[model samples]
Target: MRIVFILVLAVGVGLAGFAVSIAKDRFDQYQTALAEQRNAILPTTQVVVVNRQVRYGETLTEDDVSLIRWPAEHVPFGAFTSIEELFPENDELRTVVRIMEQDEPVLLAKVTAPGEDAGVASRLEEGMRALALRVDVSSGVSGFLRPGDRVDIYWTGTGRSGEGVTRLIRANVQLIAVDQIADEQRNNPTIARTITVTARPEDVAALTQAQSTGSLTLALVGVGDITESETVEVSTSELLGDVEIIAEGPEVCTVRNRRGADVIITQVPCVN
Candidate 1:
């Protein structure tokens, strides 16, 4: 009985030693793997990134951005490294050129100048001209029209037929400014006395002449709407339905001449 008890104790001790040896080997392997992973990682650098969603034309402030440690190997080209690089001496011109998502690296190409305002030039494309039009409550789409909205412009006045007519003078004009503000970043409703739009140089001439001859009104297009331009006009008949607008032109004169017993009336052009 004593020999059997000793044998059992020795077996228990042997099993304990084996378990410890196995645990030590696993711990060493874990430490070696952790060291290898640390050596393989590339160095990181600090780069400016938009901490929140930013809209186009919005002025940049310190609160709108943050610095994040970015992998040096994958750091974006033209990325700003510090706040001084973005707004030097507290310049307000470093506005957004395009919509920026949260955590997006703020690249130099995505912002305007440090002291520049989001003016008319930033909103216009090449070969485009910015034209301002006087608008009332009705002509401006009841003040719902905003910057970056597309509209169809209409002119209401006398037509070449010597009759009143309302026709579409311009289609797909992009509104860049409402009142004096350009490329506004908010979605709030505003009533602007005047609005500016970007137009092709060729369309500017027609818009200028139309405003002088008649009144120009805007029709807002649906957001994300993409449609082909079609001819849109409203005559008195079209507006009232089943009504005809008669154009008065040169008057015709009737002459009655008596021959024998019959009187003949002839139509002739009226002289001044």
Candidate 2:
């Protein structure tokens, strides 16, 4: 009876040991999988982002911004990784040139250079000039024109034939300011007496001439619109859809005969 009891105890102990071995193997596999998952995570870097909504012309300060861990591979171009790079010691503070929302990453394009004001000049690209055109409620897209919006300019005046004509003068012209406001976040539809646009030097000269001799109208372009406007012109007659009818004279046949050095011609009825 004692031997039987001893054998039973030995069997129970071996079964317990086998169960422990299985659990240990499963725990080791789980630990290996967890380490691999941690290694597979993308590396991150600190990026400067706005802490609150910032509008154009507003000054950007250290308090208004914070650092966040952003994916290193997906960091935006011109992003400032450190606060020191964005605000150098003894340098003038930077100003916002474009609207930036909360938590938005600060980019070089959205802010002006240090000490630079948020003006139309900051919005103009190199080799581009800003020109202001006179506009009313009617010619300014019903006062819905805003900064950073694109527009198509039209000129209406008398042509060389002394007839009224309307022609598309420019297409996809970028507006930098509406009246005195340069903020792109302005949504109020106030009638702007003048709107400013940035264009090349030659384009500015042409637009000046057109504005001087004719009325300029602004046509708002749709957001993200990349289609270019084709050459378009409408004359007074064309607008009325009037077609000119030319009077056709009766068809006549002519016969010519040469008699020595003299030639004789006779007109006769035409035969089909």
The candidate scoring highest on TM-score is 2
Query: Model 2, range 1-272, lDDT digits (tens) per residue?
Result: 99999999999999999999999999999999999999999999999999999988889999999999999999999899999878889678999988889999999999988888887788878899999999998999898999989999999999999999999999999998998999888899999999999999999999999999999998999998999899999999999887879999988799999999999999988899
Error of 1 at 16 (Å): 20
Clashing pairs in 2: none
In candidate 1, what are the lDDT values of residues 49-129, reduced to their tens digit?
998998777888989999999999898998998988887875554888667899999987677777765667866777899
Q: How far in Å is the alpha carbon of 120 misplaced in model 2?
A: 1.5
Say which candidate scores most in lDDT.
2
**Each candidate: what lDDT?**
0.85, 0.93
Structure candidate 1, residue pairs in collision: 93-116
- For model 2, what is the error of residue 179's alpha carbon versus the real structure, in angstroms, after optimal superposition? 0.8
Number of backbone-clashing residue pairs for each candidate, in the order shown:
1, 0
